[model samples]
Target: MTSTTQQHPLPLTGRIAVVTGAASGMGAAIAERLAADGASVALLARRTERLDDLALKIKAAGGEAFGVSVDVTDQSSVDRGAEEVRQRLGRVDLVVNAAGVMLGAPVQEARIDDWTKMIDTNLTGALRLAHAFVGDLVKAAAEGRTADLVNISSVGSRGAFPTHGVYSATKAALTQFSEAIRADLSPADVRVSSVEPGMTATELGANLSDEQLELLGSTFAGIPPLAPADIADVVAFVVSRRRELNLSYLVAVPTRQV
Candidate 1:
């Protein structure tokens, strides 16, 4: 077996993890994987029913997960969610900043409101989590434990694709922020990285207009798109390694996604 596929027990068992936007898609997948690998997971999202369903599934499978509801764009909501996790799980060892939104409105017709929503959810959301969780991650690091702050970035960060101007900007900002944190937190042993995904089959595009979604569907029709599970697989690999091992950055996109 390849080293990656070989039997590796959960390196993060007993370690707490907080995943935002955990109701569905990549967030849900990552939460499931981490719990499967023995980490106690805190699931955060705007929807409680979905979160509850996911949490029940985890419990059924003998893994631990707590359902939480928080609007990432709201500071109080974010703070309250973090506090709840702290009270329940004791310490947070991993944070996957996955709460995000994308509305494909061309610059000409795009409302300022839509732009603000993207900026708030995709960019500010990640920042709020980092600000709230960094102190705990540092404390974990001081105890000789490696904590991770993995930001879910996008390939859109590097280019302006048609109506994707605002969305691209948010992702680009997130990528830059992840890089900056890694550089600044070296002494704290907090590993920061961005997982940039391209052409994944998730509800991430659900916010786009019907026409835009149709266009995207046509554009990716021929490709074998990556699933949320694929992204989760990569995340599990990154988190299961020894404290010294760090996955600086990972860009997992479809091979035919050009």
Candidate 2:
């Protein structure tokens, strides 16, 4: 008697993913998870050393990954990074705009520079990346493959909080932009999604002021915040769905934060 054996295919096999802010935190986790899901990943961030190390680890784990030093705030840098990813990993099938900054200050004492930085990185940076790789995404979709654009937003976008004015505004804008672009890209089979995470144990709070830091600390003193891996899991799920379905809007927050 002859026996037949079957091999299961990886969900993201032969796909290429580009993750901004991949040097650490949620971006790093997302990159790693995508690589694990059989997608070749390009890690983009300002921290070349961190990216390099991450790439090494991914490669060592029998996955394909490359690190590109990119400052999302600069159009030229974004263009160059996108070109490099195409050259290295072929056309990008997935792009995650995860590079962002959160600097909280009351409106009365808000620093113009901080707000500007937030806008540049959170709103404009996402736009720059979208503009640069959108054509690539279109091409990928035209090839009858799944293509996705995932934007990392914050729950602050939907809620009001002291000192989170500008940060929240940027996230809100990102959410709206994602919805608009999703409609535009749907014809090309490219799906756009915005993920809003309430709180996660990452470096996002390092830039917070003393008062903001204290507020955060006291707010979740005993509650364990969501982990970077938690958000990464959601991102992976959003992009891994069947080509016919799209998970447009998702909010993942700690249950206790409810």
Candidate 3:
């Protein structure tokens, strides 16, 4: 007698995913990876051109993708972006808040503007996105679908670094926030995860001042930083876990880093 069993491939097939900061770096890589896993992805970022380019690339690869301009720091922008995703992809089953800024400097010498930008982008921006999509996440989970909220934090959140005072503070706040929300949401089966990545090769540090860069460069001297795809892989693993499993907090750093 032949046994009959259903074989399913592609874990995220038919899932609708919304990724912020999808125009570049880890965000872009995560969006692409999710699409490849069979999710219809909505790419959100202020850079419309880059989002368009990524969307096109995903489509060419036979994956579903839509690009939308979203400034996470702006409540109205986030709301509008959420609406666009809902209209284009139906209810969202996954939300990844990857928008962040790392402007490092000695606290005394730091530009107030830089601190504000980090707080707004790295902390409050994540809150905005969460607020806009928590309902959908809860509903999806209640309906027995996978629902995930992933926040991209930093290893800087775990300790003090010479020039990363305010930056570290913001990330620390984000990490704590993720924990608090996870407590509230996990009971509903909505997974909330914080991904804290250590030194990574991305445009995240491109805007740093020369002094800060030199300081960071020496600090990470011989260690090869992680690639965006590495973080993307972690995210994919987290969201693809079984419904009963939730990898809540993950810190990903280079193997050689102390």
Best by lDDT: 3
Q: Is candidate 2 or candidate 3 better by lDDT?
A: 3
**Model 2: how far is 86 from its true place, Å?**
1.1
Model 3: C-alpha RMSD to truth?
Answer: 2.0
Ranking by lDDT: 3, 2, 1
Clashes of each: 0, 0, 0
How far does residue 163 in candidate 1 sit from its true spot (Å)? Answer: 0.4
Better by TM-score, candidate 3 or 1: 3
Q: Per-residue alpha-carbon lDDT of model 3 for 95-210, expressed as tens digits?
A: 99999888877777859998999899999999999999999999999999999999999999988799888889999999999999999998999999999999899999988889
Candidate 1 regions off by >4 Å? 1-9
Report the lDDT tens digits of candidate 2 across residue range 1-258: 999999887778988999999999999999999998899999999999999999999999988998999999988898898889888888888999999898988899969999999999999999999998899899999999899999999998998877889999999999999999999999889999999998898898889878899987787677779999999999999999998899999999998886
User: Which structure is stronger by TM-score: 2 or 3?
Assistant: 2
Q: Tell me the lDDT of model 3 at 161.
A: 93
Number of the candidate with higher lDDT, 1 or 3? 3
Q: TM-scores across all candidates? A: 0.95, 0.97, 0.96
Model 3, TM vs. native = 0.96
RMSD to the hidden true structure, all candidates: 3.7, 1.3, 2.0
* lDDT score for candidate 2 against the true structure: 0.92
Candidate-wise lDDT, in order: 0.91, 0.92, 0.93
